[model samples]
Target chain A: MSCRPHWISPRWMISALSLCLLVLAVTALMLGPAALSVRQVCQACCHAVRGQAEYDPVTRIVLTTRLPRILLAMTVGAGLAMSGLAAQTLLRNSLASPYVIGVSNGAAVGAVAAMFLVGKWIPFGAVPVLSAASGLMVTATVFLFAQRGRNFGHSLLLTGIAISAFCSALTAGALYLAGERLQTLVFWLMGGLWQATWSDVLIMLPLMSICLIGMLLLAPAMNVALAGQRSARDLGVNVRRLQSLLLFFLAVTTAVAVSRTGVIGFVGLIVPHLLRLTIGADHRGLVPASALGGALLLLTADTIARTAAAPVEIPVGILTALVGAPTFLWMLQYRAGGRAGV
Target chain B: MILRAEGVRFGYHIDQPVLRGITLELCPGRVTALLGPNGCGKSTLLRCLNTSLRPQGGRILLDDRDVMAMAPREIARHIAVVPQDTPTDVPFTVRQMIMLGRYAHWDTWGQEIADDRCVIQRCLERMDITSLAGRLFSELSGGERQRVILARALAQQGTVLLLDEPTSHLDIAHQLEFYRMVRELATEGQAVLMVCHDIFVAPMFVDVAILMVDGNLLSCGSADKVLSEQNIAAAYGVRAQISRTGEASFQAQFK
Candidate 1:
């Protein structure tokens, strides 16, 4: 019955998470096959910024290779986490994530199809675009199907799950047709940050920023929405309009992230839930904290994937699932133990 | 504030109707209990008043203004609803849950300003849940949760408050306490309308009783006039005996 507020308020949580993300970004930039010290990384960055550094191997690796990958990781992680938070709130289900609505599978199908048609006629640059388009198409289908009922959130979750399964099957068939390119296709499906480029970062950054800002602005509506649809309407939330808006933004952000990262999983699901456990469910705090927490989790997992095997690099998705699944299970057990206040 | 519904008609299916041309008015500073058997459209009528369900054929007016033309937020600034048995999965603290009542008043960034915080604190104190402010809403018991929801509705600062089966799940003591709170709310100049099944207890606390049977209002008057033994038997289709327990209190025994 203690009425005292927690000492670590949401503002403090956000600040601490921001600090963690900054430290992780710096650490991620320092790790990789071609190791660079912190000083070397900073000098390379400054040199690149000033356009005065010689074309040294260290500078090239740090600037052209590692930096873009880290930025891509951060953006993709933040975007997916934001989308996941929206999905959870919209559906009123804790297990919901960015991929719950088939965005990742749709992107996978697009990327695999792009790989098939790449050498024939389609250019390589069209992969992310096609991926994003297909992801949106899938989302639209789910949205339309869910809109047919009064219980939109529940129907949406069910439709998304069914479509997600179907899309995965299509992706599998595309992989089967990709006989010669199986290894590369499987690598992409498993997901990695090694292929990130400055172009990927440029494309994803603005899109994620817009969606994230929009979601933050709509955070109060999202909080009211957690009171259930009837209560949401009573609280002056235009439930239908709010659901559509949130679903649209979630689809855009998830599609953009999946198109770039090629089907990374668990970052969305794990980050938001963990932040909810620590910071509570106010979307005002949950959105930004989830963004940073997701970035930290994915970047750390990517770092471990890169350094753990030295030469045979693990797909970052594999590492995240390996860690995330156990953590989620542990959390479920903890909550079941009655200490989680759930 | 006066909320009036004129010839409100609603139905789920094409042929069968849930609410049949119902008309009612709620005035400020009065506690009116909507009492009926199950599936009598008492809940539906409350929904129509709260704008959660739009009646197919009728118009609701708030202060003689068309309610249909008003924005959701504008309607929310006047009428607040407490729904029945709403279970949520989100792990929000009691304070955060109450703060959701201020959503219509929030600015674009939805920041909790000083006045919003003050309102929330006052609501918590009014609902006697200041000590439970830090507890998770999902962790509270049914009675505590009901009070929390009432606190949230109070925080909405609405003049007309509608509750759908507010004490349907509470113990006898909690049920009495809930009606006392409703009476307190009425005395504070808020109009209170509640859908209730406990015909025995409602007559003791509510100033007015609205008896509905099969989507029709059977009686609307003072509790003694509306909740008489014959009216209760007709509304519930059961024999009932009304015995006066005190000068102003009465209890019904079903035979």
Candidate 2:
């Protein structure tokens, strides 16, 4: 596990990513439309803690707007990436991101359907709950398919595509019935922290911590899992329990992230995939590294999304996809064929 | 640990069982080869014995306790397995690869305890793979990879070892060396049940042979007695002349 030099090892990767996260958070807090100097950022923090006054607009913006947005981005990003790593391990598929495996699509289906058609009858919480249910269904379907082991190629991806397509169609049908709400659904599906608030951070933090802890606990088994499923089981992993628990957590975490921030694509895939290559593949380290890597990646993407073209903000999802979609293409050609560890 | 399968039955489909009520016991210090032609269900039977597959009919017992009812860790403490193929692309150095065998023995946090490291070292050295410890498992040649996988299984320190044709893909020299290692382990008081189709080569190294045909146990006894030419023809549908080359050793020439 300590194969790499200390500088490049998984522990180092986690350290590097954590350092990057701190720097990026501060920078993100400073670089918005109303530029806040370091002094202003400091004042904003102090003012936030002291609850002294709604001082100048600069501190006000930093404290009220950028802080919550950045926090949400990191938490959701960490959540998705951890879930993504867990899903990849559980499914034993390199391409198994929440988006690729239809978990995100399932969440979208639940959110859109609930928002449009069932809103009157259901409580406000139905969207997230329904999204998790649908996500679980999609995940369970793929899990069963994989267990039957038509694995090691595009078959699993194809199944995901089919289920995701069905989910998307259902969403579209719901939107068709409620045509006026189409804009909102489209915006949510595009995914952003555009409306980020303190409440969103509060909602996402506990889930992120849970994902991190769950992933860390599952990390060692996940390391053995890299040996492949049958080997893992024979090596004393309860493969059934490991796979199902991973899928359950993956679906829940991904569904919650999607519900909170809509559907931010590729954090899960790119973060874990990149971390494994750069640091190493031992999950004990990969789990924490991916969490930090996801936070760093998404926060950076978000910073650029806000500042790249000032007043007209780009959705963070757009920024992530700008890199993610190409990475997915590269993986489709490379890691899919390089499906040795899966 | 003595592993015994009694009246074990399994099938992907109910009407066509892959292991049909087969009963067998593996004794300590014996290297047993489960032999048959392709699709004769030796591999399936091994899977059932390990509780990776639950037999449809009877029970797999480890020291008389039902394997299916025990936890995987509980079963693995006594039974380790080497499958026919491991994912070669597993991105770990040989040391890390072998460290995974300690998964069943770890506490919740799973830090490698001092005792675990000692076992890993012994397994690595015993497999003659100490020199390859720093190399990635995926970078090894086929024979080296098999040796690494064997060392990993040995790290489990189980009394019973199950393998499924672990050397079928290796060259003849490597195949012989692999079985020699298995024989050595068996001599050290481990009960080994290996599923292999090297009918010609297997009989030379194994202590006993369990011949199977279409999911039924055809014969089980000393290799010389069970792998008789007639039984070979019956189990594998092949004509062969099995000659006892030496005391308790054999060579098979296919017709």
Candidate 3:
């Protein structure tokens, strides 16, 4: 809508976005307090690949510190972006995001509590598991509320809002209770890949891949659904089943990412909208494009978050919201043309 | 395709049945006009005929196979429905919108084939919306949207076409054109059942007329025979005289 060069193809846009992602990945690997050169990063990666023992500082830094953090950032960004695309498609609302389902707020509650309570060795593993469970439970609650009415989308949105608000209140209560480790709790809530490890990467990578491929497969079905639920049903689509599968994939994807990385908000909201504008609204292309766009966005934001200030690392969530909110608003204002009237 | 509904009964709530003891069949090579007053469950019956709604008390058969037992894609491969209103604010080209009609024609992983492209081109041409093919769906006017919807349904290439209030948004000329298209489609062996309100003009285009009142089927026969003065009055609660509008068409004048 905003005067894009129509000659610029969506395929080119996606390729460019991927290239940027790769470039950013390289740049992010080399940037830190102990600024490794490109050569150091490559040598460390090669050494790790060959299964060399890592008494070396460079391999430890690259493999354990930057690489997992980058991988985690990419997965989380991609997962949330795909979830947003799924939500927007299923709800038939351009403004809808994965967070509209309230799962992240539930994860916030689970994570905030897990971060503070049970002092001695509840295990770091409890955070993501507890968070994911609570997030899923909240979604189940929203689904239960949606089942009471005929207009499932309307009911789901309203119920998701109510539950999310309630969860935010619960999270606020936990924050208030954390008197000693309050700063650490606030930092976690602000969200970052500051604590990324190989375990986190291993946990999220497979799920992200599966969701990406699943969303790609469901893209055409989602296109039919954009015509409205009843009409989609009339066209021989199993609307109920499609809705359930979409909700499940998106909800699980967002819940896991939020469990691991706290609540990073705008990757979901901005990535789909941005890619929809660039790649057009055909979900067949938009789903994969969104994954690339989101990875690029969050990876860039994380790189800036850590390196912007010399010593104090800013939360990646803060940077994303700060960047994403304005960019979304600008697109909405300037790109408010007939094609974007939806 | 013969879509047969046997003693179909449906109700949104348990106590209030919108369609009660309805028995009918939509046969190919004939256009069937479902005529009824407001709240007469004509739309509900159309939905039932397609796989959109299940009858609470009766079974709908599609040429000996149970409609309920068939998978959605299987049913969709044979049946195409143009709902009363589809969301048009979606950001898809008219071409892409019509392409969605082929969702049931192929598997989940299947790409758009040569046949799909040919069918889409035919639909676009048939609806006289070829020039609007590359235009955004949200930019179309109401009548244009209606035509696009019709094209999308036709693009399904199904044997059965179910339309509900399709001509509501059309101008008189477009409405006539739409009915003509429906008749032509019926002549091509598509079982066409459309929920229409214009008892006066319907007899001109449709081969059969089924009249209803308060969810009860009053009469169903050849258009001339079923659309009598008495049947018109019974369905609409009005006294009217039937006048021949054309060789095979009739119009009603109030007494």
The per-model lDDT (C-alpha) reads: 0.86, 0.83, 0.86
The local distance difference test score of model 2 is: 0.83
- Candidate 1 interface RMSD value: 2.3
Expressed as tens digits, the lDDT of each residue in B201-238 for candidate 3 is 66788888898888899998888888788887777878
DockQ for model 2?
0.60
Candidate 2 runs further than 4 Å off: A1-7, A53-59, A114-158, A173-182, A323-342, B251-255
Query: In angstroms, how far off is B96's CA in candidate 1?
Result: 1.6
Query: Retained native contacts per candidate, as fractions?
Result: 0.79, 0.67, 0.67
Q: Which candidate is the best by DockQ?
A: 1
TM-scores, in order shown?
0.95, 0.91, 0.96
lDDT of 2 by residue, A1-342 (tens): 333322167766677788889988999998976777888889878877888648667767886788899999999999888988886776666667867777888888878877864557998656667776777677678766756654422455677788889988987787788678888888888898888888878878997898788778888898998898789989999877776677777877887788777888888887887677656678888888888888888998898988999898888998998977786567546644444322
Q: Specify the CAPRI tier of model 2.
A: medium
Interface RMSD, per-candidate values to 1 decimal: 2.3, 2.4, 2.7
Predicted complexes: DockQ each: 0.62, 0.60, 0.61
Q: TM-score of A-chain in each prediction? A: 0.94, 0.85, 0.94
Looking at model 1 chain B, report the run of 10 residues with the lowest lDDT sum: B84-93
Instruction: Pick out the ten consecutive residues of candidate 3 chain A with the lowest summed lDDT.
Output: A1-10
Q: After aligning candidate 2 to the native by TM-score, how far in Å is the CA of B143 from where it should be? A: 0.9
lDDT of 3: 0.86
